[model samples]
Target chain A: MLDTIRRLVDEQGRLAVAAEAIGDNADLYATGLTSFAAVQLMLALEETFDVEFPDRMLNRRSFSSIASIAGCLHELKEAA
Target chain B: MCQACDSFLDRLFAKGVLHETGVDGLYGRGQAFEAVIEGMDRLITRLAEGDHAEVIRFPPGMNRALFEKSGYMKNFPQLAGTVHSFAGSEKDHLALLDNIHNGGDWTGGQGATDIVLTPAACYPLYPIVARRGQLAPEGGLFDIQSYCFRHEPSKDPARMQMFRMREFVRIGLPEQAASFRESWLERARGFAETLELPHHIDVANDPFFGRAGRMMASSQREQALKFELLVPIESTENPTACQSFNYHQDHFGELWGIKTASGETAHTACVGFGMERLALALFKHHGIDTNGWPTSVRAALSL
Candidate 1:
């Protein structure tokens, strides 16, 4: 799930460096993942995983890093 | 961003149209700018007089408690500026003076006041109208203007820490509010055209906070709840929003318990013009020299 989330970030995020350059807990915003790109990633992730991100789960911390996104998605899946 | 724009700023300073106080995003307007602004205010009054709006004046500083209720801090925390005052004993005062003497953080002793500087002109009106109970059968219209503050300070002349927003707000049924927003948006477009500004209207949103703000912004766009009239003031590539039309869709009405004649939550909408931005747009398009402006434009502006 972490690898897949990292792959998605590489494909959709507006990152300045390759996904491989970032660690699992690296700060995405510090690495230049913009809000505009986050929305695009969110839409793609919702479609890819068939899991809708609820209002309570949609925040900067949720998309702060690949590890955090994986964590949130895992929680969402568990609840679902 | 161009030499011409910078040159005009200089000219504005020279001609007393604008006075720069050595602080970024803060300027003192001279008679010329104020005159033009007054004329524009008259123009707005004329255009909206037919609507018979009840004019309400809100002091620039709003009640801090009421401001807290508006949830402005939740959405635009970065831009919110709270009014703080020094409320300390003599010892604390001596310490504050000592800190200031040493050029340290003297503002730490300052406490929050009963007021916070107004962030938007329409914010104060919501609570005021809500307390009035149900609207009359014909609904309600309000005209208000205030000096609004945002914490973003920049050298860009268009982006100011303090500016004026002249707003016309309507409250009633959902369809009434929606149509009022639509109709006024066109009127605003026409108002820009009268000044011969190159303009465009597009869906826009308030700069929300953090990651959650991005989702809110996207949802706002998808739902088409807000729109902005963009004009080239600082840059043509990235036009500034000089005027905005917004439909709150019962957000404030529900929060404030404002009911309609039918005993339902009344929807609210507002169309506001950024007085300074629009003025800058006019100067950009017509050049800093108003004498060189087209006769029709001058006649329309009554300048």
Candidate 2:
């Protein structure tokens, strides 16, 4: 999970600093993660866990961080 | 204009249109509206078949900073809508209110917030996809549709402040991107043909970064790259661009760390249909009384 967060941070470059400033659960959208980038992350998550994230789970909060994403994955897996 | 087209336009105008703030004269009822809706319904039914199972809906708005990073503001600064905040003392507020009441210039000292209306439906999907790891060999696809907003302030119903966009996106290898886009082109063409709408396809280029956008636009004409599905709804002279197929090589993947199962950068492509524009096109072609329309076409759209 940390690896995933680190990778996302790396991919974001300067915006990752903004994410760190506001803490983990901070609104990543506010920090600088564009809608385009957010979608890319969602696609990556689906590929990683081989899970299909339901329409309800696709939102800013779900993609907020590594921890939030992992939590979503856990829920999706258990529901399945 | 046909009588049916006029009635449809009247009905649409009768219903008060809700438009985004600062964007006026861009939407309303017309033959274009009817045609666009009909066309969109047909396209949705045909595309919502096998392999395009998942139906995803995205937020109508987007993050402002993200837009800045995506170069939307830089590329189309004229069409960008910024979210802003008012942080002033009581006296400042009162003064501003007075300015407004007195018909004075009130556009001053507005601090920008970190949010913006989503310009495109597919943009918000990228970050969501990137959160997961690389895709497996076969790749993945998503069907997303949303109400997208743009700041084009044209009275032409075709250039709306807010409009519907349905997109089929694929993330995988380069070959997969090409194949996905090519398949969509065929499907879109067939779908349009069913509606008996005159359409054509051509290659297109994205408004690239910096000085390159001008060169790219010129080159688009030279190469006939970007194909637009044009229909004469708003103006007979200028056909509206209702749909487009875009191939974003590794640009998005590189920006968001999208990778294939093999750990290589993935290619992305999307086929988008402008639901509103298509609807308008349909209304223009077919009369307002959809009940009298062909049974098969009506059944296909579930109308």
How would you encode candidate 1's per-residue C-alpha lDDT over B91-124 as one tens digit per residue?
A: 9999999999999999988999899999999999
Q: Estimate each model's TM-score.
A: 0.79, 0.68
- Best lDDT goes to which candidate? 1
Native contacts kept, each candidate = 0.22, 0.00
How close is each model in CA RMSD to the real structure?
A: 10.2, 16.6
- Find the 10 residues in a row with the least total lDDT in model 1 chain B: B1-10
Q: Indicate the TM-score of model 2.
A: 0.68
Among residues 3 or more apart in sequence or in different chains, the pairs in candidate 1 whose N, CA or C atoms overlap within 3 Å are none
Computed on C-alpha atoms, the DockQ of candidate 2 is: 0.01
Clashes of each: 0, 54
Query: What lDDT, from 0 to 1, does candidate 2 have?
Result: 0.69
lDDT of 2 by residue, B124-198 (tens): 877778888888798879888887887776756566877788888899999998888888778878787777777
